[model samples]
Target chain A: MEKSKTNPNKDFYGKTLMGIEIFVRSLIEENVDVVFGCPGNAVLGIFDALLEISGIKIILARHEFGAVLSASGYARATGKPGVVVASSGPGASNLVTGIADANMDSVPLVIFTAQVPTKLIGNETFQEVDIVGITRPITKHNFLVTKIEELTSTIKSAFHIATTGRPGPVLVDLPRDILAEKFTFDYPEKVNLRGYNPIYSAHSGQIKRAAEIINNSLRPVIIAGGGVTISNAFGELRELARKINSPVATTLMGQGVYPEDDQLSLGMIGMHGTWYANNAVNESDCVIAIGSRLDERVTGDFNKFAPKAKKIHIDIDPSSISKNIKADVPIVGDVKDALKKLIPLVKNLNNEEWLSQIKKWKNEHPLKYKSTDKVSVPFVIEKLRDLTGANAVIVTDVGQFQMWTAQFFKFLYPRTHITSGGLGTMGFSLPASIGVAITVKDRPVISINGNRGFQINLQELATVTAYNLPIKILIFNDGHIDITRQWQELQWRKKFDEILIDSSCPDFIKIADAYGIQSFRVEMANEVEPTLKKALALKDKPVLIEFKTIYEENIFPYIPLGGSVSDIIEH
Target chain B: MRHTISILVENKFGVLTRIAGLFSAKGYNIESISVGPTEDPSISRMTIVTNGDDDQIEQIIKHLNKLIDILKVVDLTNEPFVERELALIKVKVNPYTRGDVIEISDIFRAKVVDIGPTTLTVEVTGKSDKITAMINMLAPYGIVELARTGVVALKREFKGEVYTSKEIKLIKKKSRQKQVEDDEKG
Candidate 1:
């Protein structure tokens, strides 16, 4: 909620102030500590303003994609709105994927794309692209500031909207001239928008009804997601789970919000989830879904997903409710707020019988890897988790390594595990960890990437070296895009793409060396521990460790496409 | 089922595209939508007509509310409402058929707004059904041109306005600020 009611400008509403200075001043007022961007001609005025500003630090990302991804990591880590700016045309276009990633994951980002001059907007001027038009569907909301008068309010509203209910990226595209233009400016003390109102708390009546359903349910389960982390509802989630004696299964994004090692934790649920979690959810009589969207990945086959469960969904966005599975009791508010009200209304009933049944299932079908002679990726993940004591901030790229990390690594704290769960964007971790490392200076931040994905944004190695962010880059080298290969192996008669060729894989250690970063390669199972220890011990600079594992290990506990929990692959 | 959705939105340039983009992205076809300014100059009212099942219609309203520029959404689909469409039909006419064309329009309570060399342009405002009947009656005369203001509607009860109580307070504060400024000047 906007608490500032008095317009600090007082008598200066119409007083002429340079647009460029107001831009920087507004960010300072918002308490923005850092900005990530690559400058171009269209952003000249922004660079000028930053030249005069003292406190705000501007870091140049090697690529525009890296800038936005780094900002996404920062937003997830610090729970503050991330800021990133880019120049017109190609620069603006490059930030689309990263912005879309943030949008999909509900990460709050305020992006500014400098545009060509207003007069040349439609005339196809040099280096001109309709970025606002391009980013329209991806962004939560966006503004094209044609007038200098609307600049301050647009910026204020962008920040407000980005940080509020169901937070996501909001872009503000400024024409170059508007930035340079002299405008009568006064920053609004409070944002007044007719169209935007976010519900912070839910109805007590709904909470009582949900509690009633829980009390009567003999088999109950809780599915948590990033919203749990975003709302900081970990304690409330734990309390609700213990009070009801329900097993907690999280979406891939919700990995660390509920400690994975907790007895109630069902690890991660979905296509690559534990068999026990999937079965528990499928057989549940009442499912309390807190802050998770229950996307297709989480609910494998909608027809059979929690088939018997009377769902009570708590989320800040009303649209997120019943977008997939219908909510029996939809509490439309902040998950944290709803959970707080709900904890008091519930009975302290531990369904010991139900929990014991889940424990038997977990024992029968535990998440484990084969006793392979080649280096095991899952073992490496587990060793690293054990070495870090499950407190390291783990960021990952898409595919097999990501699934393995979610399965083996037990995250103990909220925001400890970040990945491109929804968008599944490749090469997300390398740049995103830069954001996490920059925000969290005290914690050990690790970027775990597959060999194929690490090469996608390899240019960010220069950025990692320049910033000296102590991010341990763990590349699971299996010499193939194993996820697609797994599909080929299962669906086809082993006819594959050129994914298995050794010539296609690059030596990441040499690449890290070229970037002047400390590099290591571990090829033996025994070598994983000593190398990880060495890498995590080096606190001053970034290190890249490439782990060479068997090329053909497929992620199991699989749910076939359009397949239900009952049809889960056990082996 | 066809749903008549009335949305109160901020009168901004991108509001139209945002609404249009939202519907298109969700794979729903918008049959007809008309937007015009409300009594409050800063607010615009958009009436969108679309076809979907109950679940789809509910999802549509939720998506509309999700847009930041959309202030209020009322699915007046099931309510008692008054609906109207205004149409200007220009029909090809001979000197001999001009009188007959005037009589046909007159029967529908329409007006002959203009008479060209070989065309009788008639202006009609009524419910969409009535407008459809009038156009069909004139179809034999070789309709030359047609322009329509697609379905604009209002509930019979007139429940509320676009601004909320919070907006009124802000407006009062603004007026008070203006009063202080005027007093200082005087």
Candidate 2:
């Protein structure tokens, strides 16, 4: 609760401070509570400055990738800009995947990477790399800070750019000398970038046109995306849906935007989405897509996706409006503001026949999985959700388990279901879960990862135990990359190739023990519920539970690549 | 179709590279690019020429506008505009060909800026087509080297207001209200 003596009012204006300390103080001024990163040779000065900081907590991950992923998770959960730091050369290079993942998912992160001294840069110094050049394409904006005078302003600009208008990752590469240099700690109170204004309110003319279209259409569907959650417009979205009497469908990334328990909510739509949701999109006369780019996974074929419907696209990013599919009515603005403008102008519609047809499809296909004595992934996900209730945060890695968790786990609130839907990174769950635990201390955090994917960043077990975070790590041990095996079985005649990881995989329980965390392995169906209960009950420390699931089990109701959503193969 | 886009950006290091990197990474080809400082020393204007369909050009403009350093982007192809390019051509010539080259330059309204014993450098500023024609006419003398200043453009007179003054006032008011709401939330 102690405040820094060097407040922004007087003492901090012209007071001399190390560039590193000024940077840390700027983070404090921005109300950043925690940062995730690993230290290296070039960033020793920064770590030294952080050592004396009282308010900020730094979670040290075993790897740079883990640090960045954890920062991404923190950003997604808290709706704040996550801060991450890394060293020069390979350390900075290691953060590329996580940075790109965050960019694809529109998570706001301010990444700081150390560089070799300004003189040694471009001369192949021991740990020097052109990190700014390397990350230019992935970052929303980046800077290579060489002057001490520009340090504070650059950091401020980086945070502003990262958290504003269609948020994404921004990087600031600081040379060693810059961090070690002495300068006046003057942090700017406001950002005045003339070129960086974002349109937040929808144009009245466009909103009126959209309402007219909605009123005229016989059957309409509202397809919401991650923007709904990003803008915190779920309440407005639900209100607009009810006003128009339209069924709502969400993209895979848009899962938690609309409550799955609602009567009008058609679960996720697209590849691995619900049958009724896909059918509803294909059959509707008007499709109102808000904040989603309509990626290939969501729209099977660009030309065929919602072919019969008059599509209206609304988004904050102007490029995403008609980049993939042409929009009949394009409104460029923030989703929350656009929905607020639209709610009053739109009138109700009587689509009873359309709703009944969608109801029939939901009853017919209804996301079924084969019942067996062996433990199944979907069953475990359902049981976990039931036992944990809807309040717990669920994060999953990419694979069959991600889809199963997306399908079976009914999320009733926003920010509760976090996954890497865009970049589809494999080793994201564990570190991200640690981040979620840091942000939402009151809620239980559950991380689900497949065996092969979990081993990618298993070193984070040390981080989990170091913080003693009460996160429950659930590993679905399918003995291989089950999604790949499923593809080979259906298309390649079960050649199998090198997908098997049964023999080479380490004993997860022993691995957990090595990290000083409690571990459990459940092989039978009867033991699954009891073991999960035990894992969730451990509130003092972290626990890892490995569920031995059926190896050959495949996700059902999958729409093959390049296939139409209406042509889903449900087995 | 070929499109010409003019962008105003902050005069800062790596701004050009960032814009160029975006085009190359997205597989968009740039025919020519020219940048220079405006009356405001803190800002620079860049003119880029590229060929793409209507949709592709819209996307290019959108991406260009997304850069934080960029102040504004306008596609000259979408409006009635005046465009010009400047070129300096160094032509290898002998005494016999010198007279003919000078005559051709005179016909094209180009001036001879530099003259050597073996080469004559002609300076021409006009529409891109005129510059191209001048270069072609002097090419018969075995051109030694050539440099071009790409293309710079500006829209003609205002046709009318794209958005009514009333609408503009409403837009400004709405944006201000939204900002106040955001500040309240923060």
Candidate 3:
């Protein structure tokens, strides 16, 4: 059953240059439309090969981290394997965080990092790092190319593994010697990695059991997780929900899985989840959790979460099933395939008592805010939602504003909401939104940022303007790391509350102007929408709309640690 | 709401640790756990006692079976099955009341593996209830040591393969189609 390597034609031959040609050729043949990365000395040979190639657009990012994050955005938007290249050492190290972020969130990415020449390895060579060793814990798998001809198959396998089965990041580290070597290239027809097989087919017995449980339960709810979004199972999820006539609650990453305005949709649920979403979970007697791990954010106080509900967890990764919260039934397969089987079997689940109970809870504690003449964050988010018709792609950096966006913005489609949920990586909004804006050329892509989160990766602003991307960055300038300072002040009695900053900040409008992009400042509630519209009206280059507002604002509907969703703090 | 789950899996390296880590990482409470090799060398049986309802037990079973090396999982909480636990408890016994403990162990058919003037170790394998009954019987003699392997079970005559999602779908589809026809006629 194994392919014998006794055949001379199949043996790997030659040096680095031939390997580079073969590897780059395989990527081209796979129809990879773009690659985002920053090159260095070790990767110069590959760059030379890339120079001769056309049709694949290479985005030169300001930093390797920015490139990988942008690729992450592209992957999330298109369900494609995002590819990024980096030089040895520093270049490879820069990609570690982004690759880890993709791994944590299960985003498909093929990251190529150059290594020192094979002869110089383990000799403390210049610009060298043990990239493969360092990336073991973060990547699903990695490759170290020792042979020249193995390059094509290795790259092919990397792509295959990255995109298939519970997709995650994979690293392909090619040494300078391998890149300079010459070898005849032949792509492998199939992958046969022993012990690495991923199941794609749905097991019918489990589906029927899930259906039976759903039909028999008095109060049933469906909790959609990031798996649904990753699988592009929005239609399937909606169909199954409609068939069951069930209300749907989602994790932070599951925001765009369904139209937020749908009657059965309960919106995003977690630490700062909506009151209706959290309470709906509490009221359900049965929960059909598809593509979500039911993490701490989704299931606060694990013992008390969904106390009355039996869970049926559907996920592609077997490791996720009942790993956190218990499941009444577990279906280990692709979400799309599993849902396809469950759709026809789904029955009308009528629990009027449960429905009305959730409705009452929703009425008692809806997502509400009070705004004065000074301006409110929620009011700005509401205005943006209204201005964009709730249709624009929203990319958010982590902070108080990200939670506020989730609370206020009405997302109407899958992949329309993009953010680093699991990693919570700051400064992800601008570059990610720029990448999304490039592909979604006509539609507006808004990068919602906080003052602190924006400061982390503000250098990408130059990249945005250089590409002439029409990305609108709405900066919520609270003049501090408001979330942390608020936590320290609230929890620590403001002791050593040296966290708050009252100093005047750099004018973001002036910063954008320096980058050859449009800028506007909204210091009041009335000016928010008008400034936002001005930015959205731009056709070329990027725009920044800075909201100079109250700095002490905190995201409410907070679920204290070890507390249930019903214990939300309204303030 | 406590249940005993019996898992039959391949006796592969790291299987036990993987299962334990899974529960610990999820913050799931493991009330008690017992595992041992079965009559077949290639297969091992694990008995896990957890606190949860019927729904929770089902989830554990479904997830356990999903592990690549796991052959089957059976929730023997309510099913007609025979369950047992083996615990080699070392009791800190003195010269006094030593005979009473030996007499009690003999009554329960438990063998004394080692004996000392100050300590006595007993090896006993029986149903969890039987073990508890024996422990109660020996409690009066001033027992000092305690160790237990969680409960493991096997259905006396049950024979079938684990049902998967694919099979579940066909059953429901047929039933639904039948229901539609019945409704139309009615």
How does each model score on lDDT? 0.89, 0.89, 0.80
Model 1 stretches with alpha carbons more than 4 Å out: A1-17, A499-503, B95-100, B158-186
lDDT of 1: 0.89
Query: For model 1, how does the per-residue alpha-carbon lDDT over A396-507 read when each residue is reduced to its tens digit?
Result: 8998889999999977888888899889999899999999998898789999998888988889999988888899999988787878788777777577566455466777
| Cα misplacement distance, residue A515 of candidate 3 (Å) | 1.3
- For all predicted structures, in order, the TM-scores are 0.93, 0.93, 0.76
User: How big an interface RMSD has model 2?
Assistant: 0.6
Model 3 chain A poorest ten-residue lDDT run: A7-16
Comparing 1 and 3 on DockQ, the stronger one: 1
Residue A300 of model 3: what lDDT?
Answer: 91
> What is candidate 3's CA lDDT for residue A8?
28
- TM-scores, chain A, per candidate: 0.96, 0.97, 0.95
Which candidate should be chosen as best, given DockQ against the real structure?
Answer: 2
- Local error of candidate 1 at A474, Å? 0.9
Provide a comma-separated list of chain B TM-scores, one per candidate: 0.82, 0.83, 0.69
Model 2 agreement with the true structure over A525-544: per-residue lDDT tens digits: 88889988888888778999
